[model samples]
Target: MIIESKVIQGKKLIFNFRSAKKEDASNLSVLRLKIDEETEFLDREPGENFLSPLDFEKLIYEDSISEKNIFLVAEIDDKLVGFARLQGNNLSRFRHKAEFGICILKDYWGFGIGNSMLESILMVADSNGIEKVSLYVVETNTKAIELYEKYGFKREGLLEKDRIHKDGKYYNTVLMGRLANKLKSQ
Candidate 1:
């Protein structure tokens, strides 16, 4: 399930977006840790990622074959700078829905990479008959929230004290979702 696409960033950078490959496992492992360290917005803490390259390779292999899952990477000058994933349930009752998550290096922020990745993933979801896509975002991520909203995702609920950060404080998580049929209707 490879996605072939490209985006221009700030009139200078050219970003290549595609599905993650087994060969990317090593770089992704390192990049994931770096991204987690760069921000508390993600679910993991720095040095908390325990997955090895082999684990990532296995996961990518599984995701590649799963109709309800996709792993995407954004690369600039052949360097992995961002990534996004879509995870869907296998149960009969929840087959029409999926959850999406995205992360980009702090230095690469505001470059339209996230936007491109979301659009591409949504396109894949829609093509695969995924009726709804949902995600959880920390309440303080206004930029991400705004981006999601612009893509027709509505806040469905808030989970209080959902995440504890390095500041030793609890933060709420916003649950947001978008319905493919609804988007088409609107």
Candidate 2:
């Protein structure tokens, strides 16, 4: 796919929003861990058997051009601060849909980085022939929910008590989705 690069947030940041490169794997993995540490709503802890940076590098090299999977990273001042991924089955029957996920460092949460990253991902998905994109968000992540809603994603269902955190408390998971056609229609 042909991805584009642009700057956002009044030029305070620059977003390439392109396919993840092998060199980016290490930074991407680190950013993922940082995001996980900042948010307790995730299903797993940051140190719980997370994939190695080398493994992520290999995966990115292998699947970088795959139509059913897309990985993106947001860099500012040549540092990776956030990343997003979209994955789906390659089989013809399920090719129209994809699962999406995103993470950003805590310090970058309110700086329009997430919004720019997500918007770029949605555009990439739409251009790649994906009909719908789905994601699960913990109920406590109101800011993320608001961002998703602003981008036209709607709550499709709920998975109650879906995740048990280290605190021994269960949290509800909300499934949200948006159709490319629906977004275009709006």
Candidate 3:
């Protein structure tokens, strides 16, 4: 599922969001690590489950051809700054649901990049007949939680002690889901 590139004008900054290209593999490899290390909200540690360039190449290539998946990248001046993915299941039991994930660099926060990514993902999900879109967020991520809720996601449940943060204390995870619908704009 290829998304047409969209140029979003934030309050000040402007950036492009588009389908991940094969050449973006190396940058996506590094972007993932930087985002994970910069924030504890994501599940992975900096180097855990690290995917090399070749690994990303393969994954992106596969995602490029998969009808049930989409990998979108956000860029400014040709530099990758963030990414999001919507992964749908092929099995009959879970074909109507998809999982969504997004990561933006700290420098790019507060620029409506997340809103664009999410709107695009939901568009794809709705077009594909994906009735349910789900995501997991750290319980402490109030800003993100608010954004999800603003977009119609409802808290489904909580996973207690789901993550052990840098402070050596366990934190809960919020499971959220939204039924697919037309894209909403702010």
Candidate 4:
């Protein structure tokens, strides 16, 4: 099934959200590297020495099992600027839920791109019979936490010292989730 696309305008950007294609691997890889370099929450940095094009194609495109995963890309005038992914848990007990993650170029933050991507994902999850969607955000990312809350995701739990950043500081990661029934009622 084709996911519907949407556009949101900001002071300087016209963000477009659409399903990611195989051809988008290269551009998406670049965007991922750039975003990783700018954010401390990501597990690793994708620097000049990292991010092979072949690896991107294999992981993001060729090996993707679309039935259990949905990949979305955000573009501006044909340039890939961000990406969001939803993947279901493999185990039977957790199969009703999906995990989500999104990253936008630092320049694109605050332009509503993140919110749009998230809303789109939630819609997709709801239509696909996904009962719950979950994500983890570093405690310091107040903006993201607020946005998640606005989208009906409540704080589920905290993973104390879940991650250690490059700055030599440990940060807690907060888990949040929302149920499809609750979203529909809203």
Candidate 5:
């Protein structure tokens, strides 16, 4: 699905948000590794579970064809800086829900990129018949937790020892979800 592109003005910086395309595979491959390297907040280690351009291309293609899934990217000056994805389930029992995940370059963390992306994805997901969105955040990430709350996601539960960080400490994961407040009609 094609998403209308929009510019988000951040704290002295601006970026474009749009649906990811096949050509974005290479840049996304590099950016994903960089994002993972920059923080322990994400699930993957820097190089672990790495996705090659082909792998990303496949995902990009699948997302493009899937009505319930979306792959969005953020860029500045034509350079890809961040991305987010909404993955929907196949089974009828879980088809109304999707899992959301996002990542940005560490240098662009506070520029409202994440906030805008979340809002955009949610709006699109609702229009596509997704009634609920879910995500998991590391417990220590107060900034993320606050952002999620501000967007209407409530803490559903906690998974103790969900992650073991680089510092060799166990970290819990906060499970959060939000039901569609207003479903958009196509």
Candidate 6:
């Protein structure tokens, strides 16, 4: 389930995008908290993430074996900076779809990492027989919404006050989706 690494050059730095490895568990665990602390666009707050490195290792192992799952990471000089996941349900009725999520260190926000990761996930999803990929984004994340739209994902619905942040404010979440055939038509 390893995707070939693609080297990306941004204005300030360069990085590689590849599938996450078991050896990366510790790094991924720490990076997850760092990125979560850096953005409100993520579902969790700074200290809310409780997944241990062992948990990440287990998840990585599971993803490697399932055609329906994908976990990718962005590495710069061996440092993990960003990651994305496409998680599919094994239930018969839900097998055709997967839930997508992604996060990047705030310092690397505009380096096209998110764009590359989305393309990678979609490509893998298509190959794995996933017909639909869906995700929920904070209503205020216009940049992310624009990126998803560019990739043929359409806004489907809105959940009012779905997330209560550390700032003591309720924010709406926008549900978006992309279909395999839908992208082909586009």
Taking all chains together, each candidate's TM-score versus the true structure is 0.93, 0.88, 0.95, 0.87, 0.95, 0.94
Candidate 2 lDDT by residue in tens digits, 9-53: 524554454567887877777777778888886666987758678
Residue 21 Cα positional deviation in candidate 1, in Å, after optimal superposition: 1.0
- For residue 33, model 3's alpha carbon misses the true position, in angstroms, by 1.0
Prediction 2 TM-score vs. true:
0.88
Q: Model 4 residue 85 lDDT? A: 86
After superposition, the stretches of candidate 3 with alpha carbons farther than 4 Å from their true spots are: 182-186
Misplaced by over 4 Å in model 6 are 182-186
Q: Which ten residues in a row have the lowest lDDT in candidate 5?
A: 177-186
Compared with the true structure, what per-residue lDDT tens digits does model 5 show for residues 44-73?
Answer: 999999999999999999998899888999
Pairs that clash in candidate 5:
none
Best by lDDT: 5
Instruction: Please rank every candidate by lDDT, starting with the best.
Output: 5, 3, 6, 1, 4, 2
Deviating ranges (above 4 Å) for candidate 2:
10-17, 182-186
Instruction: Rate residue 111 of model 2 by lDDT.
Output: 76
Tens digit of per-residue lDDT, candidate 6, span 54-150: 9999999999888899899998898899999989989999999999899999888888889889999999988989999999999999999999999
What local lDDT does model 1 show for residue 118? 93
Looking at model 4, which ten-residue stretch has the lowest summed lDDT? 59-68
Query: Of the pair 2 and 4, which is ahead by TM-score?
Result: 2
Name the 10 consecutive residues with the lowest summed lDDT in model 1. Answer: 4-13
Q: Which stretches of candidate 5 lie over 4 Å from their true place?
A: 182-186
How far residue 172's Cα lies from its native spot in candidate 3, in Å, is 0.3
Candidate 6 whole-model C-alpha lDDT, 0 to 1: 0.90
User: How many clashes in each structure?
Assistant: 0, 0, 0, 0, 0, 0
lDDT of 3 by residue, 1-186 (tens): 787898889758999989998899999999999998999899998999999999988878888888879999999999999999999998899998999899999999989999999988988888888888999999999999999999899999999998898799999999999986643331
lDDT of each: 0.89, 0.79, 0.91, 0.81, 0.92, 0.90
lDDT of 1 by residue, 153-174 (tens): 9999999999999899999999
